[model samples]
Target: MVPKQTAEIFQILSKGNFISSNGSQARLHDCISHDDNFRILKEYFAHIGYHLESGHNYYYFSQQDETNTNMEKKLEQFAHFIDVMDFFSCLDVKPVTGTRYRVTQIAEECFANERLRQKIFALSRKDKLIDKVIEVAGSLANGGFFEQEDEDTYKVMDAIHYLETIISLITIDDDGEQKNS
Candidate 1:
């Protein structure tokens, strides 16, 4: 494994983001997928207390447990993701991996639908409709789930499957009760 590539992968995963084969960072994804590279990286990252985890065509970091402050931040981020997912779901757009979405298209839908507009406004404090959409997309892009293809276009990366899978594991039971974590 090349030392530079190893360090690059470490920098990305260390941030709690994913390296995905179909993401904007295809070169880095290919680097990590090379022969013995994942193994080498797992051993390397283990020394720093982050377990290297792989999913589909992606890799990310995981810890056995987190500090309370870290846990709080993660929970808060997850809550925001839930709201984002809800907003997309309301558009009848399933949050499927590798899906491409347009900010202008979403904004148009929000303009036509009062409920969607309200949801978007609740998610962001932006005064303009377009700014709200941009803010939401920017958040997902920063998290590595979406990649901005252009100013108004974004493509969902394979890393999004991680978020979808986590959300799917949250089960609701009889009498509309959510399962205890």
Candidate 2:
């Protein structure tokens, strides 16, 4: 039999969301991370087409038979995430797990740095600096890489390692070619 929280786990991971060990859903993370739960959940989900996958302190679902359209859409979404990651990487506070960020604080930084301001402008079309920050941060939050602690503050989630892993796997050739290793 599956764990009691199986429904709750499915509710989140089925939608492509993650349960991060440090996020508000940490309890769910614990439920899934319990003894043998990973193997149990993986086998259970495999019967239903979703392959339960684990990452650095986080869990999500994947499908083996994704269509071409879905693959294309995912590639496009990953491209946007690359830009979003680039934007966050330039900040004084890196997006390590459990790191907290304030929109107003980031906006202030952008206001003080022309390079950051330009990067924000490139990422978002919002007229206000704060809104641009919000848009960028919201993208991460929506993707399950960050969790909003409050209206203005967001905390980085361990699921961010998913992005970091993917980015790290990519290699650039001497002639400017991008290769996946």
Question: What is candidate 1's lDDT per residue for 71-130, written digit by digit as tens?
Answer: 898899899999997888788566567777889899999999999999999999998899
Error of 2 at 140 (Å): 0.7
Model 1, CA-based lDDT:
0.86
Superposed by TM-score, candidate 2 places the C-alpha of residue 78 at a distance from the truth, in angstroms, of 0.9
Residue 44: error of model 1 in Å?
1.5
Clashes of 1: 0
Model 2 stretches astray by more than 4 angstroms: 176-181
Evaluated at residue 106, the lDDT of candidate 2 is 98
Each model's C-alpha lDDT? 0.86, 0.92
Model 1 regions more than 4 Å off: 1-4, 176-181
Winning candidate number (TM-score):
2
lDDT of 2: 0.92
TM-score of 2: 0.94
Candidate 2 local lDDT, 5-59, one digit each (tens) = 9999999998899999999999999988899988999999999899999998999
